[model samples]
Target: MIETAAREQRSAEPVVRPVRPRKLGKVPFVELADGRLQGVVSSGSDLARVYVSSISAATHGFSCSTNNNRPCGGLSGGSPCKHLRALADEAVLQYGLDRVTRYLRVEAGDDDDLMSRLDGTREAAPAAGVFSRFLRHLAYLELPGSTAPIAEMHWFPAVSAEVR
Candidate 1:
């Protein structure tokens, strides 16, 4: 049994770590297409918008209406709520954090190029409202509802025992 275990461990396949269970809002929208790689997490009542900034991949932004005092997530929170960690974890798991940051930077560059290309055809005067144009172009993602609220779930750490 010891020899078999050693052989398996030596195999070329990348080691797979068990994923930790998330204890925050449900994520229904994760957009990586526009290069921002944004996610919207909702808990039926409140919503949190988390995104990789176009300015910097290493930089992360999160906004939640409930966070009127201080940001509840990892970025700004003193305690670092699970919701913040969960969104970041989801992005990192899909694309390593480094790669995601680089990708966002590249995408931001592409956006600039596109804007410059359309400069001639673009409006000479600003829109009715300052951010009206920007808001019109923004994409809104909605989260699905669960039969039972996530807050009610019982969570515990995993454990294993070996007999001698």
Candidate 2:
């Protein structure tokens, strides 16, 4: 039976115990009205890597202008933020690693486009203008390896100016 095969598959892998959802904190996910799911993964070490990689690719030569902006400077807190945690959780729950890898590729493409645009326009824009543009661009990025917006979640402020 298909169920037996699925059980066997699950058993063969190292158990990735379902983390308590609350442990993901502010990372958010949505259950659609039709029972489909969509949202950003915002937690876990692997997920953090995905997000950091995406941000780095997107803003290659740019310094973050916002004092509160943490993405470009690296995860500023002791650990990955809730946004990254939620994104990772959703990826695992829905598509697994294969899909997650594909999603990251797509996100990287988007970041490349943004970087191209920024490169084209940076000469004409002021620093603040560029920063604002970056934020606006970020708003439109579908969370890498996800089809949904990085859920609107509050991330804890970086604990110190020293980048981790």
lDDT of each: 0.36, 0.32
Tell me the spans in candidate 1 whose CA falls farther than 4 Å from its real position. 1-25, 33-35, 44-58, 66-80, 96-98, 104-164
Candidate 2 structure quality by residue, lDDT tens digits, 51-145: 22111222222222222333423335323334433444454444444334343333333223222222211111123433344345567766557
Candidate 2 residue 155 C-alpha distance from true site, Å: 41
RMSD values for the candidates in order, in angstroms, are: 15.3, 17.3
lDDT tens digits by residue: candidate 1, 16-108: 333334443364334354324445444444444332211112333233222122333343433324443454456555554445546554333
Superposition TM-score, candidate 2 onto the true structure: 0.23
Q: Which candidate number has the best lDDT?
A: 1
Reference-based TM-score of each model: 0.30, 0.23
Candidate 2 at residue 139, lDDT? 75
Q: For candidate 1, what is the total of clashing residue pairs?
A: 0
- How many collisions between residues are there in candidate 2? 13
**Model 2 misplacement above 4 A:** 1-74, 106-164
The CA-based lDDT of model 2 is what? 0.32
